[model samples]
Target chain A: MEYMIKNKNEQLTNWVNEYSDKLYSWAFYKTSKKEVAEDLVQETFLSAFKSFDNFKFESQPQTWLFKILNNKIIDYYRLLARNIEQVTDDEFLSKKTTDALFNNSGQWVSAPINSQWEEQEHLLDNVDFTTVLTNCIKKLPQNWRIAIESKYQEEKKATDICKELDITSSNYWQMIHRAKLQLKICIEKNWIIK
Target chain B: MRFFKLSCKKATEMVEKEKINGLSFIDKLRLKLHLSVCKACRGYEKQSTLIDDFFLKTSASDIDNIKIEENPKLKETIINRLDNES
Candidate 1:
């Protein structure tokens, strides 16, 4: 019994050292915020440590770690939902001036465009990108922040985020819309025109 | 109306992902109106279109070889946090 315990401890430590960086990178990509993703990675490892004894080796240790990380991400999001009060529309949008009516039918691409839209030149311009978005995210209500992070940073689909948050389809879209509006204002305030 | 017409962020996001279509009629019109008058939106539209084109043309691996900065004390930091969990 003593031998089994010692051996498992050694193996888990090795496992931690080997996979931590890759897993941290994955988490970083999903969460965007370095500190938050690092915190989650630590939580993932702690959970793995506790459950090490029960691991039956049905899957590789990496796969097992993945399962744990997925649950931790979901829980982190759920806990935030509970703590933050629901966001109201006006608090979300600066104001609804009646300048442009929404036209939902806009095609994603308008005739292939000039194709310069995706140029790496613009993406890597090191332009004051953050100057544009600095306070935009802060203005969002907590719930909307989670939705946006999951949507873009995590690359989770709207469907999956809605399912995880237990929000209806309409509510999900509305929160996304409000988040985008705030972001737009921030972008407009900071963009450098050539 | 001013915000909607002037803001091209939506168009930029969609164009980045090569994801278009599924917008409603009114949304399309609003976007068009925004694009017609707004220089910033026009620039964004141009930039996004180019980014997509580059990705489509580049056959190389999407993976970037970013140098990893080890938090030398990261493990210790995490271990200390775990100890406090009790």
Candidate 2:
């Protein structure tokens, strides 16, 4: 009995060392905050340890751990949404920026059509594109980042996101629209234009 | 043009919202009409959705760059706590 328990503890420790970095990276990708990611990773480990005996080993240990961390990310986002306050105005993006993109007659101000981005479909395989995307996501205001990441990456339902973020339907739609606009413009300037 | 008079701004918002939630029939009609006349808004819609498609397709990949290092003491703290509990 003593020997079996000792081996179990040893295996758990090994998991901590092996999976910690992968788990941290995933958590950071979801949260985009180092401290929150670290905390979630720690929480995941601790929870796994407590429930260690219940794990059936049907799935790979890494898969099991990832499942727990994914749950943690969702819970974090849900909590954030519940606690977030509604914004009174368009705080970060300005009307002038929107105007520059569209004219008084609701037409494109500059060239009506952008250069055909032939390579866009292949950008997924490009590490630099992902890096640029990550940087652009990071550049957004915290709420915008939260909104975009939750909506796009997590693929949460609009109503659920609105409930979590304490925003109305109109507010939710507007945020997503504005955030995507900014992201599109940012990518065009950095990746396509240059 | 009045019935189908969706401005570029409103048309773009509808385009973005259409990805997650279905757009209203009138809004959809307006967007289609606007896109028919407005090449820039059309380009914006296509490119904006492409950005979304890029994220959805690539998010599943093993692209790791923003690495977060756990505090060295975290393991020790967890182990100690578990020990105390047991």
Candidate 3:
């Protein structure tokens, strides 16, 4: 048993030497942050080492390492998404901007702005529009941002996000709804008019 | 009239909810009824769906093309940590 553990450690050490750079490059590419990418790569290797026993070697070691790194990236975002300290329940419930969408009788207070988005082809291909969209996403409240991120980036189910964030399903959908409304307003303000 | 009437606020909420969890028969019918008369909610639905598609496309396309130089010390740091763990 001691000899086997030593062999495993040696194998992992060799992998660390060979693949760490590639893993770091991929992590940096995904996150676009230096410290976060380095931390994620470190965590990925640590996790890979801890679970070395389960690695069947059916796949290339590099493949296995990249897979582990991908999961670590997901977990990093999940952690960020869960950091909702700046967003409070009251703020979630009473966002004045979204509230301003409707009137006392629950009708639209003003006509929903006619979006020219449909007229534009391949809007995402336009770097300026993407930059604007990215900024708008950043401007969302943390919880709302998580809701959008989990839905789009992680492709997670609504129930799973609610379960992860410990929010009710109603709250989850509401966050998404308000997020879209705000994004629409922001995009219209920044992209269309500008 | 009251039974078929759904508030624009409620109609928009149902529209978003439908994307995640499909609405029930009554809620769906009410939303349909409200939307038939309300052009603004219809516009909201279209714009909201467009935003969702943009998010989906952005996530799919954005990250893979990034290029970066790898950190030299990462391997050393990882090796040191592994040594401590064992």
Q: Which stretches of candidate 3 lie over 4 Å from their true place?
A: A1-7, A17-38, A73-94, A112-116, A155-166, B62-64
Q: In model 3 chain A, where is the ten-residue run with the lowest total lDDT?
A: A110-119
Local accuracy of candidate 3 as per-residue lDDT tens digits, B41-82: 887888787778777776665433545466668888988999
lDDT of 2 by residue, A23-138 (tens): 88788777768889888988897788789888887878998998888878877876765544544244335334545776777655565233444335666567787777777767
What is the C-alpha lDDT profile of model 1 across A71-126, one tens digit per residue? Answer: 67767766665444554674545424101222344322242233222233554344
Q: For candidate 1, lDDT tens digit of each residue in B1-86?
A: 55455334455443322232245676666667767776555665564343333323231222234334455455666656554643
Ranking by DockQ: 3, 2, 1
Q: Which is the winner by lDDT between candidate 1 and candidate 2?
A: 2
Candidate 2 error regions (>4 Å): A1-11, A82-96, A103-107, A111-132, A155-166, A192-194, B63-71
Binned by DockQ into CAPRI classes (incorrect, acceptable, medium, high), candidate 3 is: medium
Stretch of 10 with least lDDT, candidate 2 chain A: A111-120
lDDT of 3 at B73: 86
TM-score of chain A of each: 0.59, 0.70, 0.71
Per-residue CA lDDT of candidate 2, range B1-86, in tens? 67778877888888877765678888888888889988767877877766676666656655355555655666666566556645
Candidate RMSDs in order: 8.5, 3.9, 3.6
Q: After superposition, how far is residue B76 of candidate 2 from its true place, in Å?
A: 1.6
